[model samples]
Target: MTAVALVLLAADFVTKQIALTHFSGSDPTEALGGLLRFTLVFNSGGAFSIGEGEAWFFTTVKIVVVVAMLVVSPRIRTPVWAVSFGLVIAGAAGNLVDRLFRAPSPLQGRVVDWIQLPHWPVFNLADCGVVCGSALVMWASMRGIRLNGTRESDAPAEAGATERTAEGRDR
Candidate 1:
């Protein structure tokens, strides 16, 4: 989980740096023939560009999320949970760094977003990590997979059955 998070964080950082350097002050760069484009943008907001100019609030939320993940790390027994948490933590931390150290001011810095998809908001790798991680978590929950590696069995056991009744004879 740590390794995966680190790799994802690095990818987010590097890609943001590339976008900042290459796409700023230029027209959007199309790739995959308009299926994807790189459009440099600075967002002081939350997901899908909402909460614009709420950098401080978003930063605080990111901090809370990272801290919460750290506090719950010891309880992450299953690999799926670990991956989900790792991705979320990494993505939060990735944006948190921008909020802390990027331009404008501390806690007021804008996040660098560049990737654009058809009929979708412009986003970055961190967004991808967060979205994918959230999807995995939702999927696990729907599949009855618990964080402690237990699954809720579909087969129902006979409730209120006495030992004699369970022995194939009526009590």
Candidate 2:
């Protein structure tokens, strides 16, 4: 899980760097002629251009969300849920890094978003991971999957241990 998280974080960072470098001072170009485009835009806010004038608010929000996710992620019993949480965390971490240290200001840093698709919002790799992970977690939860450390047998063992403890206490 840690490995996956690291990979996703690294990939997101690298791709963002590439986007920043490649499209620094040029108009967004469609590499596939309207299918895909490498566009350079600074998102000082949230998804799809909303909250376009606030960066600090979004940074604080991300921090709170990441912390919450970390606390809840470990309690998820299923591997799928864990991985999905990991993906979301990694992606959030990548963007958080940008928000903290990219440029212009601390915690007021803009996210460098590129990679446009037809009729979709312009986004980067981290956003992709977050969205993908969010969908997976939602699906897993809908199917009644637990994504925590507790195993199915743990309950029975715990019950047995409690019985033993009760018996010992009565003696």
Candidate 3:
């Protein structure tokens, strides 16, 4: 989990720096025959530009998420769960860094977003991690894979079942 988080965080930081240097104040650069574009944008809001001018609120939320994930990480024995947690941690931390250090003052700084696709808002690698990680979290929950690496079916029998079995044995 640590490895995955570190790698993703580094990747996000490096890519954002590159984008800032190359794409800032420039028109969107086309790629993949116009299927993708690098369009630099500094966002002071949440996803899709929602809650504009609420950078402080967003920063607080991201900090809470990162801390909560870390607190629960030790119990995530399942590899998939670990990876999902790592991705979320990295994503939240990635954007939190921008909020803490970028510009316009701490906790009110804008996040650097560059990648763009047709009919989609300009986003960054951190956004991808958050979206993908959240999907995995949902999948694992629906499949009954617990954080401690146990499936629901593998757990001990319910208390009622155990009581019924004991009653029969005493007959």
TM-score of each: 0.88, 0.81, 0.92
Among the numbered candidates, top lDDT falls to 3
Model 3, range 77-144, lDDT digits (tens) per residue? Answer: 88899899989999999999999999999999999999999999999999988998999999999999
| Model 1 stretches astray by more than 4 angstroms | 154-171
Local distance difference test, per candidate?
A: 0.88, 0.82, 0.93
- Candidate 2: residue 53 Cα off by (Å): 1.7
Per-prediction tally of clashes: 0, 8, 0
Candidate 2 lDDT over 20-139, as tens digits, reads 778853788767667888888888888897898688888898898789988876566667877888888898888889899977899989898898898988888888888998999788
RMSD of each candidate relative to the true structure: 3.8, 6.8, 3.1
Ranking by lDDT: 3, 1, 2
lDDT winner, 2 or 3:
3
lDDT over C-alpha atoms for residue 15 of model 2? 87
The TM-score obtained by model 2 is 0.81
Better of 1 and 3 by TM-score: 3
**Between the candidate structures 1 and 2, which one is better when assessed by TM-score?**
1
lDDT value for candidate 1?
0.88
lDDT, candidate 3, residue 154? Answer: 92
Error of 1 at 150 (Å): 1.2
